[model samples]
Target chain A: MLRVKSPQDLGAGLLFIFIGCVGLYFGKDLTYGSARAMGPGFFPIWLSWIINFMGAVCLVRSVTLEGDPIATIPIRPILWVSVGVLLFGYLIEHVRLELALLTLAVVATQSRRQTDLTQKIVAGFAILFGIAIIATRVQTFAFLKPFGDAVFGVSQWICLALFAIYALLTWGERDARQTVILSVCMSIAAVTIFVVLLGQAMPTYTADYIAPVFSKIGSIFSSIRGR
Target chain B: MDFNVFSNLMTGFVAAGTFQNIGFAMLGCMVGTLIGVLPGIGPIPTLAMLLPITFGLDPLSSLIMMAGIYYGAQYGGSTTSILVNMPGESSSVVTCIDGHQMARRGRAGSALAIAALGSFFAGCVGTIFIAGFGPPLASFAQKFNSPDYFSLMVLGLVTAVILAQGSVLKAVTVIIIGLLFGLVGTDVNSGATRYTFGISSLWDGIDFLPMVIGMFGLVEIIRNLEQESIERNPISTKLRDLWPNRQELKEASPSVLRGTALGSLLGILPGGGAVLAAFAAYTVEKKVVRNPSFAFGKGAIQGVAGPEAANNAAAQTSFIPLLTLGLPSNPIMAIMMGAMMIQGIQPGSAVMTSNPDLFWGLVASMWIGNLMLVIINLPLIGMWVKLLQVPYRLLYPAIIMFCCIGVYSSNSEPSQLLIMVFFAAFGYILMRFGCEPAPMVLGFILGPLMEENLRRSMVLSRGDPMIFMQRPISATLLALTACVVLLIVLPSFRKTREVAFQE
Candidate 1:
C-alpha cells in the first residue's frame, strides 16, 4: 500500500484532478476549432488539460516529499451559517424581510449557544435614534435619499425610539433569549435600512401584513385629536 | 512635461472637488477604516462587500469612493497590526513585527502617528506619480496588438503565481481552475453558452459579486467561526501620546523617502501591490538604515515608517496598470476592475480619452482620500480601538447580513446566494489545503480577456504558432514571462522566497 505522506497536497491534487475532469467532461460536446479559429471549448479544454498535468505533478510530490497535513475542519459553524444563508434566500421572497432576518439570526447562532454575553446594542441603537430625531426637529427630511424615498418620517422614528428605549430597559435577560431578542431588534433595524431607506424592491410582510395595525393606530390618534 | 501633468491634476481637482464627491469620499474612507480594522478581513472582501452600495452613485463619485476604501484599508490595517499584533490586512503583516513591539512598550502612539504621517507623504507622491505617468503609459499601450495583449496577460499571470505564497504547483493549478471558471458564460464568437450547467443566472458569465463575496466574505466568516473565540486586546492610547518626538521623526524620514521610491516603482510592475511593497520595504530598511532608534524588530520607528509608506504608495500606484492598460496588477485591482465594469465602463486607455473626468477625478480623489485617512486614523483612532472590543459573536452576524444583502441587491436573483454558498465551501477547502485564493481571482479576471486576445492573434497569424515570436512586443512580453517562470523554478530564488515569507 502506498501511504500518502502529505495529506494536504494529496487532497489538493485530488481536487484539482476532479475539477479538471469535470471541465473536460462537460466541455467535450462544444466545438474546439483550430488554433486560428478558436471555439468556446478550446480555451476550457486546454485549461483543463493544464490543470490535470499540474495535479499529476502535485500527486507525485505528495508521496515523494514531506509536507504538512490538512488541518481538522470544524463543521458546526460552517453548517449553521450556510444553512442560515440558504434559509434567508428561500424565505425572503415568501415572508417579510424582518422575519427572514429573525430566522437567519436564530439558525446562524446555533453553533455558538448559551450566550450569557452582555449586550448594550439596544441602548446604543436608542442613542442613534435620539440623534436622528434631534437632527430634523420632527419635520420630515429625506435621509439617504440618494438610495430612494424619504425614510425619516417623524412618527416612525418616535415609535422606533420608544421601542428601543423600552427594550433597553426591560431586556435584562440572559443566554439564548437575549441572543434571539437582540437579533430581532437588530433585524428590525436592518429591514428599515434596506427596505425603507434604501428603497430596495424586496417583498416585505410589513407592507401587506403589518400596515393595517398601524393604520388603526393612526385612526385612533386622529379621533383623539378631533375630540 | 511637468506643466502638462500639473494642468491635468488641476482638472482632476476641479472635477472631484465638488461638495458631493468629497462627502462621498469621506464616507467611504470612514466605512473602509471601520471594516478594514476588523481582524481576519482584508481589502478584497471589504471592497467586495461595499461594492453594491456604489452602484447607485454617479461613475466618478463611485470610483472616488472605491479608491478611498482601497487606501483607507492600508491605513486601518496598520493600526490593527500595531495595537493588537494582528494583521487586519495582509499588507500590514510586516508592520506587526516591530509595530506591536512599539505598542507593547507603550509607544503605540508614536508608531501609529509615524505610520499615518509616512503614509500621507507617500500618498501625495504616488498621486503625482500617477498624474505624471498615466498618460504616457496609456499612450504606449495604444500600440499593443492582440498578440501583445495575450503575451502581457501570460506574463501577468506568471508573476502573480510567483508572488502568491506557498507551493508554486498548487498556485498554478488553482489559476488554471480559475481560468476554467471564467470561461463558463456564453461563448462570444460561437454564440453558444459554455458551462452554465443549465442555470439561467450564468448565461451572462459568472457574476463577479457572488464569487468574490463567497470566496472572501463568506469563507472568511466560516474560517473565523472555526476557532472557539478570537482573543483581542487592543492597546489603549490617549490623544496626547499621538506624536513622535523630533528625534524619532528624523530617523524615520530618510527611510520613508527610500520606501516611497521603492514602492512607486514596484507598484507599476505587473504583479506587485501593497503587500509585496511592504515586504520589500521592510527588507530594504533593514539593509539601508544605519542607526535605528532601536534594532530591527525591536520597536524600531524606522521599521514602521518604511513599510507603512511603501504599502500606501504601492496601493495608490497599483491602479496605474488597470486604468492604463486595462490590466489589474493584483486581486484588489481586479475587484476594482469588476466594479468599473459593473458601472458599464471597461477600464482601458480609452477611458482616459473618453472619460477623462472619471480617470482624473479618481486620481485627485486618491490624494483627498489619503488626507481623509490621516485625519480618520489619528485623533479619532480611539474609536477604532473601542470597536475592537465588539465580541466576535455579535460582529460576524452583521458581516453575514451585509454580505448577503450586497450579493442579492445587485442582481435580485435568489440563485446568487446559492452561488455564494458554493464558492464559500470551495474557498474553505482551498484554504485547508494551503492554496491561496488570491491568484485564482486574478486568473478569473484575466481569463476571458486572455482567450479573446489569443483567438484574435491566432486568426491574424492564420494558425502559425510562430506569430508570437514574430511580433516585437509579443516577443518581449513572452520573454519576460519565460524569465519569471524560470525564477519560480530556480532553487536559490525558492529558498529566498521561503525566507522572505517566513519573516
Candidate 2:
C-alpha cells in the first residue's frame, strides 16, 4: 500500500490534473493545425498534456516524501472577509461610494474577535460619515451629482474635522495614538502628492465651489514666481 | 568600453533629476518601506494596488517609482526580520536566523545599520553593472530570430520551474495551469474564443491586476487570519547603539562584497534573482566565515550583511532580462513588463533605441532611489517599529479596503471585482496544496509571447519542427534547459534543493 505522506502535495497534484483535463476537453474544438502551421489549440493542448504528466509525477512523489501536514482552515475569517469584499464590489456599482465603504468597513471588521461591539459600530458609522465628507470634498462619487450644485459643498476643513472624529472614535486611547497621527499625516501627504503636485485627473472638489480657492492659491504662486 | 553609455547615463540623470521625479522616488521609498514593514504585504500586491495610480503618470516616472518601491521593500522587509523575527517576505527569511538573534541580544540597531549599508553598497554596484551591460545585451538580443526567441523562452520557463521552492513537478503543473488561464480570451490567429465560457469580460483575457491582487494580497490576508495571534518580540529603543563596531565592520565588509558579486552574477540568469541570491549568499557565508566570533545562528553580523547585500543586488540586476530581451526572469519582472505594455512601450531591445530617455532615466532613478531609501529609512526605524505594533485586526481591514479600491479603480468595472473574488478563492486553494504562485505568474505573463514566437518560428520554417534544434543558439538553449531539468530530477540534487528552501 502506498501511503500518502504529503497530503498537501497529493491535493495539489489532483487539482492540477483536474484542471489539465478540463483544459483538454475545452480546447478539443479549436483547430490543431500541423506543427508547421499551428492553430489556436496546438500550443494549449500540448501544454495540457505536459501539465497532466507533471501532476502524475507529483502524485507519485506525494506517496514517497514526508512533508508538513495541512493546518486547520479558519472558516470564519475567510467567510467574513470574502463577504465583505463581495459586498464592496456589489455595493460600489449600485450605491454611493460612501455607503459602500461604510458597509465594507463594518462587515470586514467582524472577522476580528478583539474589538468590542460598541467600537465596531462606532467605527462603522465614523467610516460612513468620514467617507461622505471626503467624497463631498474630493468629488469621488459620481452618484452625488443628483443632489444639485450646492448640496453639501463642505470645505476641506470638514475633511480634517471628520478625520479627527473618526480617529478618536475608532482608534480610542488603546495605545493607537501613533497610528492616528500616522494616518493623519499620510492622508495630508496623499492629498498633496496625488492632487496638488501630480495634478491627477480625479476631481478634488466641485468645480464651481472650489474654483475660487484654487485660483487664489494659483495667483499667490504666480506672484511669488514673478518676484 | 562604450562612451555612449556614459553620455546616455548622464542624459538619463538630467531627465530623472527633476524635482517631480525625485519626489515620486521618495514617495515610493516611503510607501514601499511602510508596506514592507507590515507582515504579509509584499511588493506584488503593493505594485498591483498602485498600478492605477501609475497609469496617471508618465511611463518613465511610473517605472522609476515602481523600481524604488521594489528595492525599498527589500530594505524594509529586513527590518521586521531582524527585530521581530518575522520575515516580511520570502527573500528576508534567511535574514531572520541571525538577525533576530542579534536583536534579542540588544544589537537590533547594529543589525539594521549593517543591513542598510550593505544593501546600499550592493545597489550601487548592481546599478553600475546594469549601466555597463544593458546596452550591449540589448543590441545582441536585437539579432535574435523567431526560433531563437522560442528556444530562449523555453529555457526561461525551465529556469522558473527549477527556481520555484517546491517539487519541480508541482511547479511545472502550476505553470501550466497559469498558461491555461492565460488562454481564456480570443486567439490572435483564428479570433476564436478558447475558455471564456461565455463570460463577456473574458473577451480580452483575464486582467493581470485582479489576478495578482487576489493571489498575493487577498490570499495573504486569509492566511494571516488563520493564526490566532502573531507573536512579536520587543525591539530595543536606543538610537545611540545603532552603529556597528570597527571589528564587526571588518568582518562584514568582505562578506558583503562577495555576496554582491554572487548576486549580480546570478541575477542575470533566467529565474535567478533576489530570493535565490539571498539563499546562496547565506550558504556561502556559512562556509567562508568558519571561525566566527559567535555561533552561526547567534548574532552573526556577516549573516545579516551578506544576504541583505545579495538580495538588493539581485533585485536591481534582475531588470537585465526584461529590459534587454523582453523576457521576465521572475513574477515581479513580469509585472513590470505588463506595466510597460500598458504604457504603450513594447519591452525588448527596441526600448533602448525607441525610448532612450525612458530607459536611461529609469536606470539613473534607481541609483537615486537607493540613495533616497538609505536617507529615508535610518531615521524612520521607530515609526516602522510602531507600525508593526498595530494590531492585525485594525491593519488588515485597511489593507483590504485599499485592495478593493485598487481593483475597482483599475478598469472601473464591477465585473473586475468579481474576478478578484474568484481568484482569491482559487489562490487560497492553490496555497493549501503547497503550490507556489510565482511560477504561475511567470507562466501567465509569458504564455502568449511563447505561443506567438513558437508559431512564428514554425511559419518561418515551413512546418519543420526541427528548426529549433537546427539553429545553434536554440539548440544550445534547449541543451541548457535539459541539463537543468536533469539536475532537478536527480534525487541527490533534489534533496539539497529542498533542504535549501526549508532553511
Candidate 3:
C-alpha cells in the first residue's frame, strides 16, 4: 500500500501525456493562429498540446513520491449497488414500480434488525398486499392512476381507515416515531397547502367534494361521542 | 447604460415587492432547499416541476421566485454534501471531501457556516457584477460568430476533461459516450433517427429527469443500502461551538476568494455550469494551496469552501451568457430561455435595448435573494446540522420514495422509472470501479451542443474548417488550447511533479 502513490501518479500522468500528445498531433491538421487571432484547427490542436504537457508533469511527480501499492478499500458493495441500479432500468417497466423499488431496497439493504421466518413471510406479504390494496381498492389516494382511477368523497370510511392503517403499519417503527410523525404530518400539510391553500385546481376534485369530506370526518368524531 | 433603469426596475418591483412575490420567493427557497438537500435531484428538475405553477404569476414575480430557487438550491446542495457524504450534483462532489469529514470530526457546523457565508458573499458579488456589467458583456458577446461559439465550446469541453480526476482515457471515453447518448434524440439536418434502436418513445431521445435521477440519485440509494448504517460518525449536539476559529478562517478566506473569481470567469463560457465551476475551482485551490497536508480527496477545507463559492458565483454568472448572448449554457438556462419566450420577451441583444427594467429588476432581485439566503441559512445552520444525525434506516426509504415520486411526476410514465433504476445500477457499478461520473454527466450535457456547433461551423465554412481561426476570440482560445495540450504532452516538462504529488 505504501508504494502505491508513485505508481499511480506515474501511470495517470503518463496516460494524460499520451492522450494530450494524440490531441496535439491531430491538432496539426488545424491551422495555428497568431497570438491575436485563431484559425479553424487552432483551439483543439493547441489544447491537445497543453493537456500533454500537464500529463507529463504529473507523471514525473509520481516518480519521486512515496505511495502505497495496495488496494485502499473493499470494492464489493459498490459493485453490487452499481449493478443493482442498472438492473432497475430493465425491471421497472415489466414489473410494477412499487414492487421493483421495494425489491431493490431489500436486496441492497443491510439492516441491524433481526427477522425470523414468520417475520420475513409477513414482511413480504405486507409489502405486496399493501401495494395491491392501495392500487386496487383505495380511492382517496390516487398514486397508481391508470390502474386505480377513482374519485371518492370522505363518506367512504373504508378508504380513510385504509390510509391510516397503511401509514401506521408501514412507517410506524418503535425507535424513531418522530420520522413517522413527521412524514404523516408533512404529507398532510403538503396536500393541504397544494390542494386547498394554493387553490391549484385539481384535475379531478371540486369544492363540493372537499367541503363534504371535512364535514364527514367531523361527523364521525361527533357521532362516536353520541352527538 | 440607462441610469434611470434602476428607477424603472424599481417600478417593476411594485409587482415584485408584493406579498405574493415574497411568498413565492420564500416558497421557492424552502422547496429548493429540500430538493437541493437530497443527494441526486438538482435545481433543474425542481424548476421543471414548478414550471407549470409559474404560468399563474406575473413575469417579474415568477422570475424572482425561480432565481431564489436557483441560489437556494446551491446552498441546499452543500448541506447534504457536508452532512452526509452524498452529493446532490457533480459540483457538490468537491464539497463532500471536506464537508463530510468535518461532520465526522465534529465541525459540521463550521463547514456549513463557512459554505453559507462564502456563498452569500459570492452571490452578492455576482449580483453586482450582473447589474453593472451585464449590458457591456451582452454587447461583447454579440461579436461572436458560430466559429467563436464553436471555439469557446471546445475550450469548455477540454477544460472539463482536464479538471476531471482519474484516467484521461476513461474521462475521454465517458465524455464521448455522453456525446453519443445526447445525439440519440433526432437528426436535425436529415430528420433521421441515429440510435433510437426502434423504440418509438426514445425517438425524442432520453428524458433528462429519469437519466439524472437514475444515474446519480438511485445509484446513490443503492450504494447507501449496501454500506453499513452511516452512523460511523455521529454529529455533535453542541453545534453552537462549531464556528471556524480565526486561524481556520484565515486559511479558508483566500480559497473562497479564488473560487469566486474562477467561478465568475468560467460561468460565462458556453456549456459551463455550476459543476464545472466547482471542479475548476477545486482544482485551482488544490494547485495553489501551499503545504497542504491532506491530499485533495482527504477532507480539505479549501475543497469545501472553494467549490461552494464557485458554484454560487457560477449560478449567478451563468445567467450572463444566457441573457446577453441568448446562449443557454446548461439545461436550466435553456428552460429559462423557454420561460422568457412564454412571457413574449425574446432573449438577445435587443432585450437590453428594449427591456432595461426587466433586466435590472432581475439583477436587483438577485441581490435581495442573496440577503434573504444568508439570513435564512445562518440561524438555521444548527437545525440543518441536527438533520444530519437522522438514522439511515429511517432516512433511506423516504429518499427512495421521493426519487420515485419525483421521477414519476415528471413524465407520468412507468418507463422513466425503469430507466432511472437501470441507470442507478449502472451508476453504482461505475462508482465501484472508481469511475468518475462527472465526466459522463458533462459528456451528456456538452455532446449535443458540441455537435451542433461543429456542424454550424462546418456549414458556414462550406466544410473548409478554416473559419474557426479566422476570428480573434477563436484564435486566442485555440492558442490556449494548444498550450494546454503541450503542457500535458511534454514528458520533460514534469520536473516539478513531486510538489504536485504531495499529500
Fnat for each model: 0.61, 0.68, 0.05
Best by DockQ: 1
List RMSD in Å for every model shown: 9.1, 6.0, 10.1
TM-score of chain A of each: 0.65, 0.55, 0.37
Q: Which residue pairs clash in candidate 1?
A: A96-A205
Q: In angstroms, how far off is B333's CA in candidate 2?
A: 1.4
| Segments in model 1 whose C-alpha atoms lie over 4 Å from true places | A113-178, A192-198, A205-227, B1-3
B130-241: candidate 2 lDDT, tens digit per residue = 8888999998897899899988988887887767876677777787788778778999989989888878888999998888888888888888887858886558546788
- TM-score per candidate, chains pooled: 0.89, 0.87, 0.65
DockQ of 3: 0.09
Worst 10 residues of 1 chain B by lDDT: B1-10
The ten-residue window of minimal lDDT in model 3 chain A covers A149-158
**Candidates arranged by lDDT, highest first:** 1, 2, 3
Looking at candidate 2 chain B, the ten consecutive residues that score lowest on lDDT are B44-53
Residue B182 Cα positional deviation in candidate 1, in Å, after optimal superposition: 0.8
A1-227: candidate 1 lDDT, tens digit per residue: 77789988999999999999999999999999989798878889999998988888889989988999999998877877787687667556544466556656655666564323312432343344334433433335445342222223342343344445434543564544466566777777776766676577666677666878899999999999999
Say which candidate scores most in TM-score: 1
Candidate 3 structure lDDT: 0.61
| Chain B TM-score (each prediction, in order) | 0.98, 0.97, 0.75
